[model samples]
Target: MRRMIFRRELKSNARGLVIWSLVLGGLVLMMMSVYPSFAEDAQTAEEMLNVFPEPLAKVFGMDTLNLGTYTGFYGVEVHLINTLVGSVYAALLAAGMLAKEENDHTAEFLLSKPVTRIEVTGQKLAAVLTNLFMLNAVIAAVSFACTGFADEAVELDILVWYLLATFLLHVTVASVSFLLSAVMRRTRSIVSLALGIVFLSYALHIMAGLSDRFDFLRHVSLFSFTDAAAIVENGGLDAPCAAVMVLVSLLCALGAIGYYHNKDITG
Candidate 1:
């Protein structure tokens, strides 16, 4: 049962991965254009770091861009921009994925198979994980080329840690989207809410970062965990934020499973 569902998910996501790879490759090429200018400036990496807004640059992973005497450009392009773009893309993709089947009335056929609901859910998750990894792999490859062009030996350790932060954020988004699928009656509603939530969370995080008065708002927004700068240089997920992600995802997964289990398949 698991095998069958997994295969179905893989087949569905294959095209998505391909399209994403092309887009990600193009973005990498574009960001890489900044490297020559960043490298040639007589300014030290620390000085370049001083120019961007503290809130803005931290959001873009400026803290980790400073690796060696000559290796900060990679952090700005790969860690900062990649985290922001990747989180939104992954959220949208996940939000539409499962709910579309229910929206199309195809869930009847898919669930009618001999497989149990648990196996079906597992397969869907497997497909989600595969898609997530493939997208990151695309970015990693293209970013490799960018790093190479910078004429500095890149630090693989920081890159991998930043990717891990990305992975956690991706899974958290997928779980929320899946829960919304379980809650909402229509695919259009799911997509709208998912995208809206992503942007809303981001705005709240930015606002919270700008003023200590708004810091309380940060706890309610998931974008707090999307801090690539802290993850890349600090080599750890922020403990409190990480806890929030884990708690939210686990609760959402449980809610989704229970919702679908009791849901009237015919309705």
Candidate 2:
């Protein structure tokens, strides 16, 4: 039953997986295609960035990273889009996984099978992890390929670390949405809620960069944990941020399983 459920979930969500992977990869390709033009006028670009308000520049990672270098340019541009849109993808995917069974009036059919709620939840969670893994894997491969074609020298090791941090970010956000799916009432569209969560977290991350008063938001926002600028500069995720991402994912996933196990399901 577990195997069946896992396979079914994967099959049902396969199109979404493909679409998201293509969208993300396409964006990376489109953006990297412009790197040559930008690199030629890197000095002018840096000068233009400097004219922006200090806080605004800091919020977008123009504060510490040089736009001329590929790594810095990637951190400020490609990586930011990757994390932001990737997080939204994670949230929306997770929000629908289990809850859609109920929202689609298929919960009763699933529950009638020779399967326990635990099996259903566990299988669905497994599917979510697999989907996220595949998406990130595609993104990483595309990113590496793009970097290879660029004229600038990029640190492959740092790119690997950045990709890993992005995977962690996706998992953290997915876990949270998975829990919400387990607890929220059946609904056809949880899209708004999922998008709200991602944007709010992004806002917090921006605030953390913009003001010392909100500096603590750095710890609260998953975006901060996976900051492209920081990853490019430090060569990897910080110990504390990695720990927090792992801890949050674990806690939320466990909570989702627990709550979903006993919650009543209706057609």
Candidate 3:
């Protein structure tokens, strides 16, 4: 029964997983392909970028990373897309995972079986983690391949840390969305609210960069945990931020399990 539920969720989510992976991979490939040209006149590019306002530079992480290096350019370009777009995918995947059962009027049928609510929750959460893991796997492979094609001796340690941060970012956001899925009855608001979290977190990150007054907002933004420039500079994630990610993800997932066990499914 557990295997059945897990497989069913995976099968249902397969199409979305493939579509998201392809979209993210395509973007990474396109950005990395032009790195050679972008690196040719790096000084000119840096000077051109400098002419822009300081706040704008901070927002894009231009202040910390040099335009001349591969990782720096990647931090500004590809990293942003990976975290932002990937978070959207993560939020939607998790937000819909459990709620869709009720929205599709399949909850009654599912619960009618011998499965306990705990089993159902466990199996569904497993499916969510599996999907998130697979999505990151595909993106990481594509990123590494693109790096190879660019023929640059990039810092593998930094890249590894960046990928780790990306995965953690997805897990953290998805866990929160998973908790929301347990509370919501319909799929409509689940999606809207999930995307809202992603965009709002991004807005907070930008605000933090745009002024000193909002610097504390960095601690509240998941995007800050995955900041490419900071990752490159430190050679890894910030211990405190990473701990928060782990702690938040765990609490939200456990909360989802608890709430879902008592949730009154309409269907």
Candidate 4:
């Protein structure tokens, strides 16, 4: 039954997965295509960036903007924006998965089946994770292809680490949103709540960048640990931070499973 439900979910969400992958890939290609032009005027670009207000510059990672290096350019230009888009897609997809059945008045029929709620939640969660992995895989391939076009030699290790950290961040956000789906009665409400959480985290991250007083907020925002500049500079993910993210994701998934096990299903 779990396999049956998992297969059904994969089939149902296939269109969305493809659409999101294409959208992300297209944006990455467009951004990377301009890398060569920036590389040509690296010094000029760095000087120009220096003129911007320090706070404003830091918000976009311009403080560390190094057009001279491909990784540096990508850290500033592509990573932040890509993270935002990918996180939103992940949150929305997870929030809608189980909640859609309720919002569309199909939950009654679904619950009428012989399958248990645990099976339903477990299978659906598995499907969400699978979709996220597939989405990241496509984006990673596109990013690498674009990088190859923009540079002669790429830092394969740093790129792989960045992708891995980004994937973990996505999974954390998706798990939280999935829990929200189980808790909220309406799909619209779940989406609004989930997006609000992502935006708040992003805003907190930017605010943390703007001043030292808000640096404490970084501990709360997943974006802080997944910062591209920091990731690329450090050469890999921070072990403690990555562990915390994984723990949070696990707790959220457990909460969702527990809640769904006892949730009332009505049309």
Q: What is the lDDT of candidate 4?
A: 0.86
TM-score of 1: 0.84
Using lDDT as the measure, name the better of candidate 2 and candidate 3. 3
Judge candidate 4 at residue 11 and give its lDDT.
98
Please list the residue runs of candidate 2 whose C-alpha ends up more than 4 Å from where it truly belongs after superposition.
none
Worst 10 contiguous positions by lDDT, candidate 3: 146-155
| Candidate 3 lDDT over residue span 1-267, tens digit each | 858999988998999999999999999989988877778878888888989799989988899987677778778888899899999999988998889999889999999999999899889989999999999998899888877645558877877888889999999999999999998888889999999999999999999999999999998899987898788778789999999999999999999999999887898
- Order of candidate numbers by TM-score, starting with the best: 3, 4, 2, 1
Per-residue lDDT of model 4, residues 170-254, tens digit only: 9999999999998887889899999999999999999998998998988998999898867866778888889999999999999
**TM-scores of all predicted structures:** 0.84, 0.94, 0.96, 0.95
Best by TM-score: 3
Better-scoring candidate (TM-score), 2 or 3: 3
Q: Judge candidate 1 against the unseen true structure and give its global Cα lDDT, from 0 to 1.
A: 0.70
The models' CA-based lDDT, in order, is: 0.70, 0.85, 0.89, 0.86
Q: 122, model 4: CA deviation in Å?
A: 0.9
Ranking by lDDT: 3, 4, 2, 1
